[model samples]
Target: MGRRRSAVLTVLIALVAIYSLVPLAWLVVNATKTQEGLLSSFGLWFDDGRFALFDNVRQTLTYDDGVFVRWLGNTLLYVVAGAGGATLLATLGGYGLAKFDFPGKRAVFAVVIGAVAVPGTALAVPTFLMFSRMGLTNTPWSVIIPSLVSPFGLYLMWTFSQQAVPDEMLEAARIDGAGEFHTFFRVSAPLLGPGIVTVLLFTVVATWNNYFLPLIMLKDPQWYPLTIGLNSWNDQAQTVGGQAVFNLVITGSLLTILPLLAAFLLLQRYWQSGLAAGSVKE
Candidate 1:
């Protein structure tokens, strides 16, 4: 009976893997085709004598006078600045909440929980109007500023800090003439390494994939990130007098995942450690 249960679990895992992998595999296969081939051929497998992966990539990069590269740069900028800011704020805010008791602490938590409960999309319209009134619309700040505030990240850091850092160590630091900031930076910060990396990765992915905020905020193509840019290419493919870039879109989509996949692979160890550390307090 145990053997049968084990076999059933193995089969379920395999099925889940296949289900998740199939679409990704299809994207890879289709990315090798041309615009004509993409529409004409079977999506799951590359058709005979229709390989155009290099050309598709070449066109995807060079299209619109290399606008894709600009989009990539913009994405990198947003991810770095926005994610970095969010991580810093979350870490500091979380550390404080975890270590210190202050007035309205419960109220502050109530607000944080409420922010987490609210979908960012639901607030996008109002946020856009507010930014516009503040003369920040169509600028990078319009996106970067909003991305810096991550309620979930703050909560994650607060919980992680509570477990990863000890009050005794903080007291010792105070006795050693270390200021609060010094103690946090020199001692508490090191212990929160995994948590920091975890928050960094989460914010990076969130900022990198942010679409709706940038979409509704900026009108200029120059400020567009990869998500909006590739989407524009897709829309162009569907419109009259627009460039036929369906294949470029597919190849671009494929390219987009590579950085994220690499990021996860490179940080997988830290991510797992962070998650484990968070789950098991002290």
Candidate 2:
């Protein structure tokens, strides 16, 4: 009976894995085809005698005077500044909330919780109006400023800090005459490695994949991120008499996901550790 059940579970797991990986496999297979090959060949299989992955990549990078490269740079800028800033602020805010006592602390906690519950889509229009009034719309500041606030990241760090850090160690540092900043940096920071990486990965992925906010905020193609830029290419095919660069779009998408895949691969350990935190008593 046990063996039968185990085999059934293994089959289910294999099915789930295939379900998740099939789209990625399709994307990989199609990215290697040319414009003509893509329309002519099967999506899940490579085109015979016409592997144009490098050619598609070259055209993707050089198309429209290298707009794809510009969009890539813009994405990097948003991730570094917007996501990086969000992680830093979340780390500090969460640490303070977890470690310190202050007036209105309960109120702050309530606000953070409320913010986390609110969906970003609900705030998009209001944020757009606010930025428009400030003359910040259509500029990178609009996107960067909004991206800096990650309620979920703050909450994750807050929860992680409470368990990962001990009050006794902080007291010992204080008794040894270490200032708050010094103690946090030297003591608490080390213990927060996994949590920090987790939050960073969250923020980076959020900013990298952000579409709605940037869509409503930016109008200039020069300032567009890869998501919007790739979307524009896709939309071109939908328009009447518009030039379709579906091959470039497919190749660009593959390129777009490579960095994120690399990030997850490199930070897998830290992210797993972060998730497992507080699962066991110390």
Candidate 3:
């Protein structure tokens, strides 16, 4: 019976994997075709004598006076600032809520958890109006400031720190003449490594893929991130006086995903180690 169940689960997982990989496989093959070839050929594979991967990549980077590179830079800036800020704030706030006691603490937790239930899309219009009134709608702060708040991240850290960080360790630090700030920075912070990295990865992916906030916040193409920039290329393909850059869009999308894929692959070991270490304490 167990063997039969295992076989069924394996089949289900394989089907799920194929379902996810099909679109990615389509993207890769289509990226190698010309705009003309894309419209003409089978989508899953390259047609005979139609491999144009190099040309597509060259045009993707060089199109519109190297605008793609500028957009890449803009995306990097936003991801670093927004994700880094979000992780730091979540870490500090979560740690504080976990380790420290204050008046109305339960109420604070309740409010934060309630905020998590609120969909981000629902707040977009009101947030836009608020930023508009403050003359910040089109500025970088408009995206960065909002990105810094992560209710889910706070909840994750608050829960993790309770288990990972012990009261006795904090008391020992206090006995060693460490200030509250110093103890948190020096002692509790290191122990929360797994939770911090977990929060960082979540924020990084969230910030990197963020589209709606930046779309509404930015007006200038010069400030557009990869998401909007690639979409603009797609829109241009259907517009008058614009070159058909569908192939370039495909290649550019492939390029956009590379950084994120690399981030996950490189940090994967840290994630495993952090989780393992968190489970074992001195």
Winning model by TM-score: 3
TM-score of 3: 0.95
Q: What TM-score, to 2 decimals, does candidate 1 have? A: 0.93
**Lowest-lDDT window of 10 residues in candidate 3?**
237-246
**Model 1 lDDT tens row, 162-263:** 988989989999999999989988989878988888888899999989999999998999999999999998898888856477888889999998999998
The candidate scoring highest on lDDT is 2
Poorly placed runs, candidate 1 (over 4 Å): 1-8, 241-243, 272-282
User: CA shift at 115, candidate 3, in angstroms?
Assistant: 1.1
Please give the clash total of every predicted structure, in order: 0, 0, 0
lDDT of each: 0.91, 0.93, 0.89
Could you tell which candidate, 1 or 3, scores higher by lDDT?
1
Backbone clashes (count) for model 2? 0
> Candidate 3: lDDT of 63?
90
Clashing pairs in 2: none
lDDT of 2 by residue, 33-106 (tens): 87788778888988986789999899999999999999999999999999999999999999999999999999
